[model samples]
Target: MTGYALRKGLTFCRVDGRFVFLDLPRDRYFCLSPIADQAFLDVIAGESPAWVAAALRDGLLRETADDTRPVACIPPAPPRGSLHDNNQIVSRTSVLGALTRRAASRVWLRARPLKAVLDRVQERKSSRAGVELSVAQISRLAASYRRAGMLVSAHDQCLATSLAVAWQLASLGATPHLILGVKLHPFQAHCWVQLGDVVVNDQLDAVRLFTPILVV
Candidate 1:
């Protein structure tokens, strides 16, 4: 009765009622058939590898005599910035700037190739001046985008929100890290922007549930 476990650097998410596996180290993704998905879930939940192998009459899971790798690590939080009051008034200039960048982000996502878009974002991060925004300022910028209908009905909300926030931060001369993360079990993927480890555009608790697969 050999025990089985998910491989290191591997995560899965259920998208549109199907299980999708991500091998992070290999940068590959695989969609699992329903039977395989159930087998995987059973194995990871402490079923014997040999039992699953016999049941399927095949090698379904990797046998692990000893598994040592940590499945996830939470990044250290960044130094705290000044907290902003929810009622703080946002300046017109900041609101307009965020809206403009959000529009540009939507257009770039639609028109450009993904690699090209990522490269352009990387360039912005590298060339950004050292200016930093307060938590209040960042919150205000995100609010402005939401209020302006920039993110309304976005097909990929995480991608759209991350891009919009990244652009808004860059416009303010701050370099932001765009992050992509995955969580197994219930299986989900999420994206967000951060300054250091401080999540700029999403709830810290929410982002903490995911294991970061990419930080751009």
Candidate 2:
């Protein structure tokens, strides 16, 4: 019955590490591998309106592969001109100080499973000390996501990996953001996790490589 329902609904399924088409909600049937089915089930079971939005965004990105498109390169800022003389005073101060602070708190409050995952990932990936993510402790995944995106855009790297990481963060109950920027050369936007001025996964090179721009 479950299989039949999934097939009729035109839903997606994972089977044997492959994606399968299921014509769900129409009494039709399509089959997928056990792994795909399980993953699909997990996603479904964990479904929430919030997650739905994220999934849609991710789906759209995947469908068109826009996230993979190269970001335009931005030229270096010319020395501050007379126009900036006055504005520079304020810009130099706290540009997004409030937003950053709010975001940091939000990530710490909402993030789940981030610390554990980070620990596991670190254990497996690194042997160096000082390579730990600064905000791994806080539950502020959304804030982290935003920060990560900004870092990636500034660095110019792959966005897909960042998206994957963001998705993982959202699943853990963190609010993430997608950041876009062009500096020096063309690159993809990305996401990050944060905790009170500390960056989670800062030591992970994945931040430099993946461009996760949006939290959803």
Candidate 3:
């Protein structure tokens, strides 16, 4: 009997008694049936595929030849920008804008649905035509977010920071890319905002450490 293993980079969360799987590489999510969920759990516990096959009569736990290879989901590279620029001038208006965006982002991250937030981000990105913000402008926006304490005090960490940054950028008629990445071995997950290849909310060196699972 061939051996089987749970696919790598597959993270799951339980919602309403059902297991919702997040296929990180593909950026797809789906709920598993009770039987399939059980099989998956068993495989994750290091049980042999033959043992799992006994319970899953439909052969849902069949072994695959390429079990160790990592999945890739790279998107077309966007235009790159400089990592460093002159500090943005902090004005009363910029401060007020950051505060408003931070408050809104906090509420949206908590009260709104994940799909809804993603949809809105996509809509904003698509709606903006040829209006791209320069590196200095993005830097200034990020600085405003920092001054408003949006980046440091967010309870949701990277998610909140990314959302706040994206929101602020969108309001300024600049589209920013939201990226989700995962690191193996230690199993770390991070989200950040970017404009083209330029890291917006976080340092580029830090983001380069993880493999991007989703870019939007």
TM-score leader: 3
Q: In model 2, what lDDT does residue 188 have? A: 27
**lDDT minimum window of 10 residues, candidate 1:** 78-87
Regions more than 4 Å wrong, model 3? 1-71, 75-86, 150-156
lDDT of 3 by residue, 14-75 (tens): 43444455564455655566776665555655555444655345433345564332223454
Write down the lDDT of every candidate, Cα atoms only: 0.61, 0.33, 0.62
Clashing pairs in 1: none
Candidate 1 lDDT over residue span 1-216, tens digit each: 554545555555544445565565555556666776666555656554335665345432455556422222233454243211234466667667656766677788788765567667878877885887777677776666555444344335677668878866876789887877766666667877878756665666677677665556
CA displacement after TM-score superposition, residue 18 of candidate 3 (Å): 24
Badly placed stretches (over 4 Å) of model 1 are 1-28, 31-85, 91-97, 149-155
Question: Residue 64 deviation, candidate 1, in Å?
Answer: 27
- Of models 1 and 3, which has the larger lDDT? 3
**TM match of model 2 to true structure:** 0.21
Off by over 4 Å in 2: 1-157, 185-198, 201-216
